[model samples]
Target: MNTQQRTSTLQHSGVNEAEVSKLFRNTYSLLAMTLTFSALVAFGSMTFNLPHPGIIIMLVGFYGLLFLTTKLRNSPWGLVSTFAFTGFLGYTLGPILNMYLSLPNGGSLVTMALGMTALVFFSLSAYAILTRKDFSFLSGFIMAGFVVLLCAVVASFFIEISGLQMAISAGFVLFSSAVILYQTSSIIHGGEDNYIMATITLFVSIYNLFLSLLHLLGIFGGDD
Candidate 1:
């Protein structure tokens, strides 16, 4: 939104052009840094062939750190918590990536998945920013989809459902993409005022998007 329009809406939304611009800068910068840190941790973990922590540990660590980060978001410690969360997540992924790498044409699949993720995230995010369209309408759908996705994930452990993993991956690809659009649009339109939270949200979407792509590619491209 332009300055004049922001000024007109200031009483209602308290969002100005300068605030939005600052949020965009801070969020993106922190996101880039956190991503780089996660990559480094992933690379190191993979190099050492770290053991998989299993789903339970992974879930606990992820949610624990996420909650901690959210609580400390206004403090300097928030940055530390963000790295801890992202780094732990990347470490957890190393074992999965190694499993994929052990498959036929695994390297190619990983490369392809990463490429696709970057393409999808950047393109959708750019579209949201340039268009500056309000995407708050997607909130309800995204939230509902997230709950269903979580349930499916939990149920897969007990139920021997065929192709359930692939289905979940596909759902995540769509869900994560919508989240990126919604998050970017929210930032541009000044719905999210906190850059720390914005960074975490977008970071999570990117991370999940990449993992989902990796799973889908591995399912379709890996050798039998």
Candidate 2:
């Protein structure tokens, strides 16, 4: 290529890189903000002894926001949706916090949450950086697993069963952990091209994993 053509090509590539960096930065920054806001809401809810109705509202509202976020993943609205969803998640977490706080070993729950979060992030980050393998292949399996898990969750409401709950929780934890690996791989090499979606996926995976781990811990280490 001629000198001028080379210069033009370089400029275009530079622009692309800059845009990618901006997208990545914006996604993570927003993710952090959302997490913080949600934590605040959860703490507030627990502090005030919020009613079950309010907690339910937070749950429904958060999921509604999640639906919006998914639908608007490619638009500016997606960002707003993410913010709302995270805040809702934080609020929904209040009840769990309240329950755990009431326990003598409540601090263990918080510690478990922090530990799980750290493990997920560190493992996924490592996988993303060290491996060249594409995890998109797991997409279909993850979806199917999620659907099954959702069905089980819904079914649990109608049927009281400990074994089933344990089974489902175990399955969900494994599935979400896989999702973390997949999402990380996608961000690193799958060429997702959209950091907002990436962060959302990663956040969801981590959240679910944490919940699952907590469930397992409660099952095995209750008040001990």
**Model 2: ten consecutive residues of lowest lDDT:** 50-59
Q: Write the per-residue lDDT of candidate 1 for residues 1-224, one digit (tens) a residue.
A: 69888777775465477788889999999999999999988988899999989888988998999999999999999999999998998898888888888887889999999999999989998888888899999999899999999999999989978899999999999999999999999988878988889999998999999999998888777442
Name the lDDT of candidate 1: 0.90
Q: Model 1: runs farther than 4 Å from truth?
A: 1-15
lDDT of 2 at 212: 75
lDDT of 1 at 163: 90
Which digits, one per residue and each the tens of the lDDT, describe model 2 over residues 45-146?
Answer: 788877545645755785777778879988988888887777666666777767767777777876886797777777776776577578889889899998
RMSD in order of candidates: 3.4, 3.3
Give the alpha-carbon lDDT of every model. 0.90, 0.75
User: Which regions in candidate 2 have their CA more than 4 angstroms from the true location?
Assistant: 1-20, 53-59
Candidate No. with top TM-score: 1
- Per-candidate TM equals 0.92, 0.82
* Candidate 2 CA-lDDT value: 0.75
